[model samples]
Target: MIPVLALIVGVVLGVILDPTVPAAVEPYLPIAVVAALDAVFGGVRAKLDGIFDDKQFVVSFISNVLVAGLIVWLGDQLGVGGQLSTGVVVVLGVRIFGNVAAIRRHLFRA
Candidate 1:
């Protein structure tokens, strides 16, 4: 509940502030977002499964973003950033979908 409220508030603040990200960090934003979403969904699913842990959630969220960003950064150095970004998104997207499905089943009992 608190996390959901905080997320909503963060989005609202972001929209109102309309902050600009640095140009150098722009390329990694999407990948980072997808990774964060994957973590968020995983956390939610864990909450529903009665296994939620604050430490685990924080670690997962930070590690997901950092690792995804690192992978993209490495790819850029190798001139394969776009491909790696796509791969990260695809993997994270699948995980997000799977988590969503589990959440849905838990919620809807379907």
Candidate 2:
């Protein structure tokens, strides 16, 4: 339920926003990576936090996002924005299916 609601909210936000908003705001966006990291992390206490301490998780998450962006960027650089978009869509489809399966298994147990 939360996942679906989140998706719906994201879709609505995207639909309502200017398509150029991300680019327009990109220069102003935080470099703090994930929101949770920005919200609760600071000082040596934050450094000792388990989530921040997990180097592998941070690396993996950053790599995944950058790889996806690089894919699109490469495609655009090579005059193939459509190809990059298709690649992004493909990954998104697979992710959505995986999320649905996991939720069904965990929540429905059938």
Candidate 3:
């Protein structure tokens, strides 16, 4: 609940502030966001499964974002940035969907 509220508040603040990402770094933003969300959903699933660990969650969150960004950066250097970004998004989106399904089953006994 708190995390969700914080996310909402953070998004609201970002919207209200309307800060812009630098052009150079903007390409990696979507991948990073998707990776961060994957971490979040994974954490929630872990919590629901009674194996939640704060240290693990934090590490996973940071690493996911960093690694996703790194992958995009590497792809850009290799001239395949868009392809890699799409691949990352698709993989993370699948994971997130799986996690959500698990969470729904856990909560609703479905």
Every candidate's CA RMSD: 0.7, 9.8, 1.0
- How many pairs in model 2 have backbone atoms within 3 A of each other, for residues 3 or more apart or on separate chains, i.e. clashes? 0
Per-residue lDDT of candidate 3, residues 4-29 (tens digit): 89999999999999998999879988
User: Which tens-of-lDDT digit does each residue in 8-33 have in candidate 1?
Assistant: 99999999999999999999998999
Question: What does the lDDT come to for candidate 1?
Answer: 0.97
Provide TM-scores for the models.
Answer: 0.97, 0.49, 0.94
Q: Which ten residues in a row have the lowest lDDT in candidate 3?
A: 24-33
- Alpha-carbon deviation at 26 in model 1, angstroms: 0.1
Residue 2's C-alpha lDDT in candidate 1? 90
> Against the true structure, candidate 3 has what lDDT?
0.96
Q: Rate the local accuracy (lDDT) of all candidates.
A: 0.97, 0.50, 0.96
lDDT of 1 at 62: 99
- Order the candidates by lDDT, highest first: 1, 3, 2
Clashing pairs in 2: none
Question: Residue 107: error of model 2 in Å?
Answer: 1.5
Best by lDDT: 1
